[model samples]
Target: MPELPEVETVCNAIRKSIKTNKIKEFVIINPKLRWNIDANIKKLLSKVDIRKIYRRGKYIIFNFNHGSLIIHLGMTGIVKFLKNRHKVNKHDHYEIKFQDNTILRYNDVRKFGSIHWAENIEDNFLIKNLGVEPLSDNFNYEYIKKISKKRNVVIKNIIMDQRIVVGIGNIYASEALYMSKIKPNKNCKLLSTDNFKSLVKSIKKVLQKSIKAGGTSIKDFQSIDGSPGYFKQKLLIYGLEKCACGKNIKNIRISGRSSFYCSNCQK
Candidate 1:
């Protein structure tokens, strides 16, 4: 699934290509998504001007004058901008034809993605309850300490919880824990203030680096231009079985998600 960095990359890519453009037409190749495409989505979005594009958590928001369009690239989804007419594939489920002949196409092999219409983005059900953005000032050492103190689950699971912190998916959770030298399965409550500080810093550092690298392309993820992310080449522990510290990297299941860390390095 595309996480925060992937979603952010999509938003930036699409914004640069389609900002200030008018939507001449909206086409839905199929309405069957994770949630059925809203019936009024076409009526609300077609012929409107795309004012801006932004991201919240893993969802992309396309802002217009009167309303907004929200899209989630659930699992095997990619959004691409085309300059000319091309062969449409079976998975190309949604599209927006711009006035300048540029096309924005949404293709998902699994059909797990969704497109929603919202009059006000903040009040939408999907955007309202999401926790603080990991890269924002709102997420800091003190906040992580307070949230982790109340959870008995492993630190990995605690950070991965969307309500406590948004956008730390499986890949990032493992990478952050490795960077912090904290065992993924260690109880959150057992972590000291210093440990929480290190964890918070690691989370931010890992996220920022991945975003700069255009996110990790383990599988199926690609930039809007159909290029694979280069961050995977810089991974320290996510898919490796050994560590630079002369220790084997352990792989375990925390809340049913794979976690990687070095036993000798992490406490």
Candidate 2:
């Protein structure tokens, strides 16, 4: 699945290239995605000007005069811009054609990706209860420390919770915990203020680094340009057997997601 960084990359790319551009065509080759797309979406978006494009969590929102178009790139989904002459791939399920013939196409091996039209994004159920963005002012160490007292779950689970903080996917969560020298399985009650401070900084650092590298391309993730992200080469603990501290890494599942840490390095 595309995480925060990947989604942000797509938003930035789309915003830069297509903002204020006029859409001449909107096609849904597969309305049977994660949810059925509105039958009138094509008519609603045709000839509409894209006011802006942005990301909220993993969903991409395209702002227009009438409303917003929300998109989610579920597991194995990718969106790319293609020329009119390029043959549409077998997985291309949705597309938008600009007046200039530029195509913004969505492809997914699994039909789990979705596109929804909404008058306002806040009313969208998918993002209604989402937590603060880790890079935003609301996700400071003080906020985390306060929340920590009320939650008894594993520290990793708290950080990864979409209700507590949005966009801290498993890969970045593990990397941030490892960077903060906190074991993934540590209880929230066991964390100190200093630990929370380190966590906030590490989370921002890792996420920013990943976005700068265009996001980690573990499986199907790729930039809007179809370029693979370079951050995976810099992964420290996730999916690794050895740590930089010359210690064997430990693997455990937290909330059914793999959590990697070096017992000798993380405390």
Candidate 3:
């Protein structure tokens, strides 16, 4: 699935190109997605100007004159731009054609992605309950410490929770834990204030680095330009069986997601 960095990459890649474009039409090749695309969405967005493109959590938000379009690129989704005359492929489920003869297409092989309309993003159900962005000022060490002190779950699971902190996916969770020298499965209550401080710093550092590298292309993630992300080459231990410390990296499942860590390097 596309995480925060990947989502942000998509948002940034298409923002300048799509902004101020006049929407000529909206097409739903299929309405069967993780959430069904509303039938009235085409009429709602007809001929509106695209004000902006932004990201909140893993969802891409397309701002318009009267409302917003929220898109979740579930597991195998990629949003890209193409010519208005471009041929539609098998997985191209949604599209918006601009009067400039360009098209913004959303393709998802797994059909887990979704498109929804919101009068105001702040009042939308999907946007209302999201936690703080990892790169924002609100996610500093002090804030992380406060949230960590209240959780008894494994620190890995704690950070992965969308409600606790948004956008730390499985790969990032492992890398950040390894960077902080904190074991993935360690109970959150066992971590001291200093540990939380390090963890917060590691989280921010790893996320920033990943975003800079264009995000990790583990499976199906890709930029809007049909290019894969480069961060996978810099992974520390997410898919490795051995660590640089000459000790075997451990693989464990927490909350049914694979977590990698060096038993020696991490506590």
Query: For every model shown, what is its TM-score relative to the native structure?
Result: 0.96, 0.95, 0.96
Runs in model 2 with CA error above 4 Å? none
Q: Please identify which of the two predictions, 1 or 2, would achieve the higher TM-score against the true structure.
A: 1
RMSD, every candidate, angstroms: 1.3, 1.5, 1.3
Residue 266 local lDDT, model 1: 92
Error of 2 at 127 (Å): 2.0
Cα error of candidate 1 at position 115, Å = 1.2
Backbone clash total, candidate 3: 0
Model 1, global lDDT: 0.87
Q: Roughly what TM-score does model 1 have, to 2 decimal places?
A: 0.96
Residue 41 of model 2: what lDDT? 93
Q: Residue by residue across 137-206, what tens digits does model 2's lDDT show?
A: 9999999989989888999989888888988888998999999999999999889999999999999999
Compute the lDDT for candidate 2.
Answer: 0.88
Report the lDDT tens digits of candidate 1 across residue range 1-267: 787888888888887777447888888878888998877777776788878788888889888999889999988889998876777888888888888878899999999999998889889998888899999989998998898888778898888888788888889898898899899999999999899889999999988898899989998999899988778988999998789887888888877778898989999
Among all windows of 10 consecutive residues in model 2, the one with the lowest summed lDDT is 12-21
